[model samples]
Target: MRASPPPSSSLGSSCQSSQCQTEGNCMTDLGSIRILYMEDDPGLARLVQKRLKRAGYFVDIAEDGEQGVEQYQAGDYGVLIVDQNMPIYSGLQVLEILSQTGELPPTIMLTGTGSEETAVEAMKLGASDYVVKDAAGGFLDLLPPVIERILKQYRIVEERQRAEEALRESEARFRAVAQTAVDAIISMDSRGRMIFWNHGAGDIFGYDETDVLGRPFTMLLDATCHEKNDPPMSFFEVHGEARMDRGIESLGLRRDGTSVPIELSISNWETISGVFYTVIVRDISERKESEAKLARMAHTDALTGTFNRHYLVGLLEREFQRAKRYNHPIGFLMIDVNRFKQINDQYGHTIGDDVLVAISHELVETLRESDIVVRYGGDEFLIILPETNGETEIARDRLVAAMAASGRFVGLVDFPVTLSIGCAHWDPQDPRTIDRILNDADEEMYKAKRANHEQEGSRAQAPPTFA
Candidate 1:
């Protein structure tokens, strides 16, 4: 036979559970978390207090159910753990008193096998969760999950209250700023039902507040919603609420059947009986267009519309890596006009520019799609050949043949323009050093120029232009 716990009384200690000193305890380390623990057994109360203290909890102990009720009524405890039997009252009685408040802290009742009826009564009286004492198997194991569940509920409730208060505060702060937020704030429910649509959202989507509010979110997603075979269940499914900070780019089909790109972030939460989603959406059509323009500019040569030197360098590096990775060879050639400066000076600068343009056109026609013909600089060009024997003399011969076939002449005598060429190959095992390779090609080009000059019996030729 066990004595009944004390009856309910007005709460004592304005601090009550708040007074629990979490110093040197796990509960304290866990952060200002509070608990109310009631037991008629003094020894058991002491044992639990010690354990809980070690776990960093703010634990307030009561010797009986009546004292527990008084402590709880003072409020501020995050959790209430009550024993079913005590001297003046039972856990059920305290639970009954707390149930009437409609806003009591989360409560867990402790009962022995003999007090099973009391446990049922405690539940009816609104105990959140329960634990069995003395005769338990897995009692200690069961304690954590019960406490965690109740505490989680308590925290959820408190957080929601805090969130509402904060949202009000935020709304006040954002009243002026909301007009200028880069993105619109739109929201819906867990079921994809719309709850909010801000002015910015309306402007971006070409919809008015009256048209979007009280409507399903799918109306905004429109056809894009069904694009995926297994479309995401909700915004939360695609981008979790936890990662709401990292925005997602989504395609939104407007009311006019046109598609607009949008960056979206969503958060899902509950308030009272309703669940809501808060989405921040920004129109990214301008951003996308800007990016596209930048990409083209990055890859293009302003003067010739061919790959720029920077892009060409990147392509060469890529090809080099590929050849190295696959144990393959690549061929490249450096070609310079035999007497370009004299052509520039005699023909005038306008004709000189035209000559370069013509040369580029002729080179493009002569090269394979796999080959790159880049204007290395004024009057000098580079050709790259993938999967070729770099040492093959045919590489230079090809350039010579292509230049002759172009039929574009710079001389007044209609003499066919010519290129003096030098070629090199990449060897993965012994690397074709960039400086040495280019230097070798330059040397060969100069050698070819000398040979041409000697063959023509004219050693009085101008040097290559620096450009």
Candidate 2:
């Protein structure tokens, strides 16, 4: 090997040190740029190395092209400076061989003064730049600035490639999420015309992408509601500001011309093209149906499907206050099925429940819609008549006549099916408590029951049974 250049200069540092030799399998350390120079002239190599080292570079020298390639493979370098005329191989030959290993570093080719043709040929062989050399060594001044410019260009290219790669990955992730999501994800332009429809939107709306890509977004809403909404109401876009929603309920018109309940959330983004909106929609029909069923179960009697005692308590309090305020006439009918226990004991509880259900239905059908019927207790019902207008007994008589005409229990095992009906009128001006008024109706009912028993003692027949 040629003697090592003086410590004052090197074209590339001898990486006898383990760290530099193995770095990324030859990737240079950018923090400290190290360079390799190949030249047959020892004096010229030494001068070049010293000048570059003074310019803040670590430099090492190889005597010829063959040695230059060998030293390059053995060390990490940020730059390469090679002489065109070498003792064993030409600088172009060295460049051609080094290209096979991997990408070469920012490189400068050294040529004799006035040999611009040789310098251009070196550039074609992958040299980043070329330096004109003379006996006086005027080329050193150009070397540093040329190296800095080439390095800057390399960094710009790498940054551009990374940015393009990141953008492609982001687009791929968006396509995957949009294609697989279960909720309808729809995109609309600032004017609210549909632009992108994904798999979820097609499945929900019963339309192909081609069928609705250019349609108005409001086509998915009920006609009556869509008119009120238009496009401006669907999203909040004020100036450059955009707003997002947690959820808003709406009616969605399906392709089959039916309406479905849906919930929507929206997001907005802006691009050079203009503003855009994305809407996510979820179907809520099942939730609405469940809520309605639960509400009914909470307020109605489970066995007979009539308003239960709990509902009646609230209803009575409101009605009581209203009557006391306006001095209106309110009537109560305390109705009890005669011998209901004897019917259940003879016919079984199954029939007893059926009888109660039938009675509840009959009471509802007989009364005005404004009237209230409550299953007050086993075998007992309370009917409320608002603004009775002195027709309390008349209303009770009409119910009895209707039940007889319907023959509700006439053939049920020959049992004498009858009702003990008692009426109590609320005198709004009186300071009596509701409990006392209800007690009066109860006492009147017992009196009616006793009278019915005395009147029918000779005629009442067998206990009721299913017909």
Candidate 3:
């Protein structure tokens, strides 16, 4: 007599050979699904293979667990169906081997009757699903559905893993950019509490992540900042409406309690978690110092350190306007160094420059702080005395007296430095432009020069005194 078929679960009385063939043929029409089958029993293995092939599956049969592992490594099968009781190695061993090779495929295990313990052990070893073999051989009907479900689940797991890996890479790139930026980059929550601070922030603010995290953003700003009236949260709420691409200049407070000028740009974004604010801060101390230096260079005379003509013109025009509006008197003194050309010819240009500088120092010393002194070009100076009504002569006399007291010029020593000064007063009622008034002073200065020459001619026989 023929050997009885191995005990296995039945698909039901209706699922006989004819019905199995129909179901297999119907599944086969869908696609060429590949499966690796491992069973020690040749009869059972052949039966399952024939049924699976009929149901649109390309099935590879392995008579033992070792052959199963070899076939699994050699072929790219979508699913592996292994019988638990096998030669060389058990089905669980085969699953473990496949897992070690790489990510194992969706797997289903076939267990003999009364071998439920072995099926459970196979699952622990990475089997996706398992079915028990019965006398009716019905487990073959359940095979196709279990493989289909496991394959669908496997695709979902793969897609999820890929998505998670991409997210990690994206976050790493963003962190790298933020940490390497030159300007301090900071992020805070809607409550104005610090959440993230990059390396640039630590470098600029002198505060490490530990010192700043969860702290109020106002701690890093001066008390006199524009947001002083609002609390930290309120300030963030107000500024979080839009992006500030252009940035505003303000003072930033350092951890050492000193203040630094900073250019700040802010931007905000929102997510389901909450709103976030980002600030980019740049220290502008060097830039401000450079600008101040440039302004001083523009307004000052290089040689004598007095106001240059360009700056003098602007100051005079402003003073003129103020005098006219207030109906006040403004005095302009045109001063020329007598025999300056003779001094340069006899003593070289360096001595002439020294003489000019010395004279400028004297002028500054004699004048009040309110007076404007200018180096009006080579060998000439201009002094503006605002609100000096009838005191123009008194001011000029005082300057001459100061020069005489210094006792370092022509008559006192050998340097021959004397000033010929002519004064003009602006009367608001006169209604003349500042330029015309200045011209009047210039003419008077020339007249004074000629008068000095005549006096020198008359006094040629005697030693000279102060002009």
Candidate 4:
């Protein structure tokens, strides 16, 4: 027969058959919790087993520590309660074996009185807790609560591990995307010091990680740009606590000290440590060059390389407005190539085209840099002179001299090629529109042409004097 179970205030009296029965429906209500108990003392083991079984726990008993290891491996137990002073292998030795084999369950070590050193050693070997058995066997009362507490703590640890694993996987995915991005991706601190630079940054800026990490981000900005604005600062510096998302077009300096047009976007993120800024940069140099080329093609004449009619009209309107506002004198020269159609008829259109090209070159060389020359139409051109008074005749004389010196018509035609020029000056004192001034110059040009025709076709003719 088993020895009478150790006396307990609650387990023996309060836990009677009616209150804590380990039978059918009652046992099902108290979830199944299998416990493995290893103790060298038969009397103590029998008493503890009876108390646990009555409380609806399924208890498996082992005679010594060595048997405890075999029972633990053979059966599934939610908790292990082993005696520290067991024969052969002790509680600490059993814990070591279980730990080496695999994961151990929630464990509690039972030590004899004044064996605090053994209890400490057991705990260090992976026991969750240890109890000192009293002469009255009072330690048996503490086991249930200890097991519950250990299970709660274990759940907490498992949750924390899962969270850490998820964070690591997220970081890995972000790194993979950043490494393969085509645009330069960079991260910096509030002080504009580089913290991270990806592969695209190296390809765009020609600086490897070793060369740029920990350096100021201003190293990649043109010196002139830095001087024009504030010192290169992160998005956090400008906006303070607010989140920023914006893009700017600026010049980025390369490793070789040359600058490229760059489109930069800034985004800010906040963490417990501080705010960080992410910058995405794209080189726009090729796009800028393409736009400039398209603009030149729109405003310039393909054959003569002079200002096209569209651009010339805009220039004239702008100049007229300026002259009206500033009370400045402006001059206009309307010129026509003499006998151009007759030359084309006599020597084919190719010779006529050559003559027109040569005339355009001569006019460009003769005029001052401030003068505006335009290829207005077939066999016709316009020259605009700003901030001039009483210089119209001087300009006409220069053009005649330039044409005589130029040998463009020598081989193609027997007669000399000359220009009939009409001049008109805007006196701020006179009230006249741009259209009126242009019409007057055009009418005078035809008069010069008629006069030259009447005078046995003089090489060049000048307009009449204006009052």
Q: lDDT for each of the candidates?
A: 0.68, 0.76, 0.77, 0.77
Strongest candidate by TM-score: 4
Compose the digit string of candidate 2's lDDT tens values, residues 1-467: 11111111112223354664664232223337778999898988888888877766788899989999999999877778988889778987887787756667778888885587887667676777787787776787777677766665555555566677798898788878998998888888878888888888877788888988878888888776555654643534421232243577778888888888888887877889888888887888899999988887887889988888888878899998888788897999999998888888998888888778777877888888988888898999999999887788888887776766665665463654568888888868767788988888888888888877766785645321110
Model 2 steric clash total = 7
lDDT of 1 by residue, 367-403 (tens): 6778777777777887777888634367566556777
Number of residue pairs clashing in candidate 3, backbone atoms closer than 3 angstroms, sequence gap of 3 or more or interchain: 11
Q: Tell me the RMSD of model 3 versus the true structure.
A: 9.5
The order of the candidates by lDDT, greatest first, is 3, 4, 2, 1
In candidate 2, stretches whose alpha carbon ends up further than 4 angstroms from where it belongs are 1-157, 160-164, 186-198, 207-257, 264-280, 317-331, 386-388, 407-412, 425-437, 458-467
Superior by lDDT: candidate 2 or candidate 3: 3
User: For every model in order, what is the number of clashing pairs?
Assistant: 18, 7, 11, 0
Query: What is the alpha-carbon lDDT of model 1 when measured against the actual structure?
Result: 0.68
Q: Estimated TM-score per prediction?
A: 0.49, 0.61, 0.66, 0.73
lDDT of 2: 0.76
> Worst ten-residue run, lDDT, model 2?
1-10
* Shift in Å, residue 128, candidate 1: 35
